[model samples]
Target: MSYRVSVTTIEKFRRYMTEASTFDTEESLLDSIKGFFLGNDKTKFGEAWGKIIEEGHKFKHVSGNLNGYLVDGIFFSEELARPAVEFAAAHPKMIYEVPVAKEYEVNGMTILVSGRTDGIEGNITRDTKCKFRTPDFQEYVDSYQWRFYLDMLNAKTFYYDVFEVQGFDSLVYDKKGIAWLHDINIIPYEPLYCSSYSDMHDDCKLLLRQFFEYIEEKNLYQFLKPYKSNA
Candidate 1:
């Protein structure tokens, strides 16, 4: 079966997937958005969320408690270290940072995307969630988070680290056995890529347009529904 994605969604997906940009404040976000809209920059919500979620996998707890924060710090540090270490581990010839840059194109409206990766070459591209069941890796298809980084760098495999956090005395059920496990779970994900950025962007834009149309239709229906009811 075929799926439909939009440029706006792809924009959002790419932002969501690319694993860089660690600004955790409202002001910085506002500044980034202003820059993107004004053409001063391109690191908007789409790309930011993509990368944010991607790195978020390393974090185990969605609850944001003390333990979670500890793990988060470790994860963030690891994310920073992954690129440098991976390069060092794989190729003794050269070392590089995770490529972080913006790509721009003029297709009627300006299209900008950020490229930040952990440089874990030959790894899977995936997102993490706080759920028991593993999510379908395909969910990141039009995700502005993953696609942006994957597209910008042309990565063949991606990973999602969905983590389930339990207390120190929680029991786990698995095919092997039912035993008490620690407070963290790790799930890795991989997605398939076929189209180019331009193609993905077109799909994202279409979805955004359709989303606006749906909102308008819903609002109109609500407005008319009351009138028809009175009649």
Candidate 2:
């Protein structure tokens, strides 16, 4: 089946469909990181930020078209559109967009998830990634952000594809501490998520759920107790 998403959602996380998570508190330094990224387009970024402020923080911009590549609305080279079209042509399975919970509020502070899923198939859900530069394995792992999405879906397994075009040359070391690089086409074998992967993803869900509960009830001290002790 064909698919489409909000232009805002599609544009917001131009790199990945979703972000990592919302700020822990309004004073958190995460805003700085956001500023750094959004600063890439000073003109558009300023306009958008001004809108956010003017709207009394009630509304934020988001894009729905997350799956498609971020190319000009026109296809200048058959060489370029070839891959995007090829992917859709090959994956005849119907794709769909799913809204998974990520954002949460802590003491009137909005802390939500920072990511979105491109779409889902019968068993394999998919995300569209356009990487101009090579993505290390850690970068690849980070892209999955499976913990958040899987938690929302309450599923055990998932399959993802990373579509890369020229520029990537290095690999990233995953948490398991393995490093892998891309030497051939970006579309390598699908990463398999065994039971171990499921358990880890489930743990993230539990973490977020507990975090939301604590914040929703105004339990900041108790909510941050664990982190403080660990630190």
Candidate 3:
């Protein structure tokens, strides 16, 4: 049977390769690794912010009440949405929530990689990230997610639109004790044209093949267990 995986999953496997021994069983380890892709509070807020930005970009030409178009009320407050909205207004050409997917054959196994990019404009693909502190641009460049997006989209440039919203006075952060203002910065890095692009692609494929082999070997034991549970 063919296995479906995403770039995020591949990245998680790479990260937890050495730490899998921490889990009690292979099934538990797999479940915990899968949890990395699940939505959490931080990701939820980032999605909300991205939605507000997309809405603002879509309706930038319209006049009158923009608040009605923006995401507001309990979930998304004015403070949190303001900068994203403002940024969207400034750059109206950005296409939001673009879905990109592609399948590859690695070591005789079908690997399906897919992701929804935050935005894409011209030859550049952009990902909006909200964080409590400034992020390292090199980390973004080195990330498997970014590399996958670049390869799938065939994009020339990749930009990380990082919104450092540490000090925004919102109810979301009332008790968290984060009170230092930060700025939104767009850090652009060229991926496809990089000197190490070919090498990186080779490394990713090898890592993925190793992951699939490990999973298949582990699952074989489950199938060959002596006793089966009736419950």
Candidate 4:
């Protein structure tokens, strides 16, 4: 039986497993980790924000994407959507939410990776990353996205359109916890992900293999989400 998953889920599992200390308890971490396989994502704000931005490419900020979003109402959500919206407008040719998929053979196990690209303008693929703090460009260079997307598209250049958001107005923290603002792009790299392009296949295979073994050891197979084919 082949397994189907998204790069999103794969990375989520790896992150939670390796950074287990971040969660409050082992059970909490396990639940959180399992939630990924159960088709649950905890980053609602980020997800909604991304959706709102994509809405811009098509010139709309529908309600569901902004539900309970910003305190200033839909206006804030619209505000958050502005930068990328403007960028895409300027680029004018980029397509948002483009689907791409690939299959991999990991230790005789077939695993399929499938997902949508955030934006693709010509040969350059782009993804928007929203950050609460000032972003270090290096972080963008190190993400799994660019390489994965690059391989899927067979494009050499990738972009990380980054947006730096500010914290809410506050009294205690020395930082001006205030008013606010953030721009973005998917113009895209990373250290561990620094392996050469030719090594990408091997790197991905190893990751999927390790991921398979990790889940097997943790006995998480039962929680795996049902992809259309897998279902």
Candidate 5:
């Protein structure tokens, strides 16, 4: 049987499988894999801060939080997100939210990875992240998104538009948790200079091979479900 995968999906699988996050079971991770492949909301609602940061990219900031910033009906750090969106929008040539995709064959199984990027300018691609602390740049360095998107767009470089955020409590309790935003620009940790696209293909093929082996050995295929790609 074949599987549809995404760079994000592989990262999610790897994160849950290796990291010390709350979802610490094979069952939950399988469900997460299924959810991501099927575009279910499992990953979205799991945490609030990440979702808040993502939503913060949607629009420019308003002057004051007089009404209090609410996401999913709960107060969140809207101020922390303002600088990211503002700076992200400042690029005149950059187009936000571009779709990219490709298919691969790994160990006799079909794998399709697809997703939208944060922005692309000419041959340049950029992904934005808003964080409460200084980022471990290695995380971006080790990501699959840049390589995949770079090759898909046949782009020059992928940049991480990381923003640092710090919280400032409001005088009123309910209106608290507003934050200050600092923009940090990053060069590509792994620059695809020659653009062989072989490293990416080989890396993806290996990941799928290992992933499939795990599924087969653990008998978790039942959780993967059927996927029909939009292509």
Candidate 6:
């Protein structure tokens, strides 16, 4: 049978495995993946900035103000506006929001793993994040998302462009005296390396097998019923 799973869900499943030891088989893993779907939802900031970063990657020139476009009660502040525009203008040729998928056979079942990269230019895949604090490069290096992106995109290097958000109490102004209240600054982090590509690939394959086994044993479809009705 064909099973569809996202990278974020896979990450959550991995986290669940750490807390609960019940998912020892593929059936349980699949159920766990679907069981925690509601809890795995992205934050408003994550959703908003993700779109902005995707647009920046795709457009060569963005006219008008980005602050005009808001999603889920989140908007680009003055601090982020200039940099967002600049990043887009700078990388006109980069591929944005590229969907990628890789399929694996886990215990005779088809498991399709999928994700989308923020941007890709040359041999590097870039992921942008609007963070409240500085990003840890080592964390990214060990991330499942990073590894999956590398394997699926066939990227030589993975780069994270993290924007640190600075909030202000009073009204802030730009050089032109335009009211821009938030300050978004880019932090430094080196590109991550997949030194042991083969090992990572094998690990993912094993995870997929375990995930499917857990699902088969646990009847994961029951948890998905509520979500389907809501949809």
Please provide TM-scores, in order, for all candidate models, with all chains considered together: 0.35, 0.45, 0.66, 0.68, 0.64, 0.66
Q: Write the per-residue lDDT of candidate 1 for residues 6-71, one digit (tens) a residue.
A: 233334323433432342243433333333334211122122223433343434333233222112
Q: What do the candidate models score in CA lDDT, each in turn?
A: 0.36, 0.39, 0.58, 0.58, 0.56, 0.59
- Say which prediction, candidate 1 or candidate 3, comes out ahead on lDDT: 3
User: How big is the positional error of residue 162 in model 2, measured in Å on the Cα after superposition?
Assistant: 1.6
Candidate 6: residue 231 lDDT (0-100): 13
Please write out the lDDT profile of model 3 over residues 72-113, one tens digit for every residue: 222333444566667778778988788897666777655667
Which candidate leads the pack in lDDT? Answer: 6
CA lDDT, candidate 5, residue 5: 64
Q: lDDT (0-100) at residue 18 of candidate 1?
A: 44
lDDT of 6 by residue, 43-125 (tens): 44555556655563332222265433343334455445556566667677889888888776668656678888888888878
**Regions of candidate 3 where Cα sits further than 4 Å from its true position:** 18-29, 32-38, 57-80, 167-196, 220-231
Q: Write the per-residue lDDT of candidate 5 for residues 1-231, one digit (tens) a residue.
A: 666666676666666666734644565676666673342222222223334434544433344654323444334344443443345346657776778877677676666677788767787787766444455677667666677777667665788766544342222223554333224222212222223255776776676677777778888777664455445
lDDT of 2 by residue, 1-231 (tens): 111112222223323223433522333322322333342322332232222222212332122532222221111122333444455556656454556654333334334444456656675555554444444545546443554555456665565554444533443445644332233243333443422263665455444444444344653433221211111
**Candidate 4 displacement at residue 201 in angstroms:** 1.4
lDDT of 2 at 72: 14
lDDT of 1: 0.36
* Ten-residue stretch with the least lDDT total in model 5: 184-193
Q: Give the winner by lDDT: 3 or 5.
A: 3
RMSD of 1: 15.5
